[model samples]
Target: MKKTLMILLATILVMLTGCGTENKSGGLEISKDVAFGEKDYEKIVSPANELGFKLLKEVEADENNNIFISPTSLFMALAMVYNGAEGETKEEIAQVLHSEGIDPEELNKANASMMSVLNKEADDIQLNIANSIWLNDKFTFQKDFAGSNKDYFNAEIAEIDIADSKSPEQINNWVKEATNDKIEKIVDSPLDANLVAVLINAIYFKGSWTNEFDKNETEDRPFQLLDGSFKDVPLMAMKEKFSYLENEKFQAITLPYGDGEMSMKVFLPKENSSLEEFKTLLTHENWTAWQKEFEVEKGTILLPKFQLEFEASLKGALKSLGMKSAFDENANFTKMINEDDQVSITNVKQKTFIDVGEKGTEAAAVTGIEMGITSAPINEPFRMEVNRPFFFTITDEETDTILFMGSISNPVQAK
Candidate 1:
């Protein structure tokens, strides 16, 4: 076999990683999405999109994580941090984000464009992206640093006193609002006193599949696990002409939502193939090509009606993506604040919400890069029953931007 990254690590990580926790439920209205023109957006998104594969591969290698992440949320949060970084700290992050040759100015412009296209409102689709930077009022912040983020990234600059008892509630409230209450408590109480800043990116998405599945057809079906055992999961069955692809290795399909500008693509390994073996075939190139390979074919697709809230510190996974010094104590973040303030990334964490049902899909993710610390496919005509572990992605069809990516290893926990 090539290389195997256990695919069910997501299940394990959800338990170990401080993932989804609800604290006061509600949504908060933010400024608005920024549009600097979609000109260079693809330049940055395309390369950074490569990190998704690297992450899954990392999860595979670690084999102790629940596989779910928001590529847009994670990268955009880092992009905010990148602007505040100087020298080697900047260089290392650039390489990890795959924007080594691109100018920071151009990359910033591209990111603005990417956010604009993905966060825009569409018929039958509600996609919202919120970015913000929280600073300790006790310290002085660099204006140029904050302005670049506000103007280019459209981030909300909030100066909150960390010493206050209500700090976590204050920040988590914004997170709840940004994600439509899907993610309620990303900021835990007892704020790290050493935390000088908190940079956040929240994405909330709710879309109905163009062809909704009939609820009557939904039934509990046997879903095989990696351990050669099985569990019952509610599988919503639908038969229609779906953009699908079938090859020797896997069966795939693209189920469009709203006006077809976005979709949820699923890839299920063939009965003879395992997810571990199938993961070796994953690459950014293959994902790009797989989206184009789908031909509208007739078949039945049975997907589980499941929901999960996951959160985890991404330090290790990011390190595997070629990032280092950013997490170092002596890391360079002078541009973010004064050198005496001395802040490097103390923690980098993300909390995600994923749900798929007969109505459609509601997916959200919040990526927090602690500055306080310094921080597809388808083919169906052949019955594509996701009766086992499989991978899925909520994507922007127009831009091919992935909002949320995940794998369902054990649907027993799924609703």
Candidate 2:
């Protein structure tokens, strides 16, 4: 009788311990511990840089038009879906993400770490990143995939009736809240019935310049367009010592924000050089070299007061980047649901907003990865004026991670 009692006690203890290890809701287990370190950051930066440039190149192919994109937000959304991919589908995504050697588990940990780091706040600076997964209430998801996202991305998982009219509104409301209302809506139309899941990532950033431009100095100035035409724009002018660099092709300057935690780096191509021609020179090696060339200098600077909003469907771009399988019928997303369900990515979309003025910069971006279908700155002390088309990047100073990138060809027509 004593031996039997001891065996029963041991079994009970084991069951209780297992229960504590996994957090569960609606019959799904969620992971609670996910972390990463410096090595993971090193892995993340390479892929981010590659994707940023590639997207820029594609968006600029139209030429003579303003373009903006948030590669970081897009990456976060897709990385969540990547957790549910398998076989060649997985391999293709890994390759496009520049995460070839890293496993999905490690990728999640890295993204978790990155989000934590980027979202850290400082006086007068606000950075927020939020993620969510919305699932069709009638459909069941693989436990591991949902749990991994919850554990690593800190994503909110919601089971909603997709057939209901309020479903898209709920998702869009979450996105609006996450981005501080800069992006009001991501899902412009109703979702399809075949859609099984929608994964979203939204980011909001508001920072004051370390040295705010004086509103008194603002004046209407001529902004040259790519077509050799010029239009008057509200230009913010100042003279201050700033981080500056220049070479044969372009002159670049860094405008620090919020105690130097983040910055806008602008690259203005030399006269007679087209912005498109200069873009082709944006390689990791060249970017590193340019950073090395920055030195403190005092000169006059003139930049436009501009606001912009941009939206795009990224299916074709991702396909061109070697992630074709995820959208095809044969795509293997077995890890997300029952194998017989036959789900593939249907669409991927992003929306972004930015405002730059004398006080500082406020920017927001939202990226939605719908697996349902299975699918800048400038300076001048030595007198640098942003009178024409130029490229810019908003980045974290500590990690050198780029959050937003774009080109302004005509400031008068910025939006």
Best by TM-score: 2
Instruction: Estimate, for each residue in 1-415, the C-alpha lDDT of model 2 and write its tens digit.
Output: 1110000000000001001112111121223465567456566876888787887777533233877788776676677778878998999888878888678889987877676676545565666555667777766768888888778777688987877889889977776566444455655446676556666655556577888899999999999998789999999988999999988888888988878888889889999687889989987777777788899999978989987777777878899888998887767777877535545676676666667888887565656565543211254469678888999999999999999999989767545
Give the root-mean-square deviation of each candidate in angstroms.
18.7, 20.8
- Model 2 lDDT, residue 313, Cα: 77
TM-score of every model?
0.77, 0.78
Per-residue lDDT of 1-415 in model 1, one digit per residue for the tens?
1111110001000111112222221233322543355476778767777876676676432242347776666677777777778888888888878888655666777877776676645457665556666777766567767777777766677888877879879877776666555556665677766556666655556567888889999999998877788899999999999899989999999888878887778999999998878878877788888878889999999999887766677888888777788776657878876445545665566666667777777666656565433221253567667788999999999999999999989877645
Best by lDDT: 2
lDDT agreement with native, every candidate: 0.67, 0.69
lDDT of 2 at 81: 71
Weakest ten-residue segment in model 1 by summed lDDT: 4-13
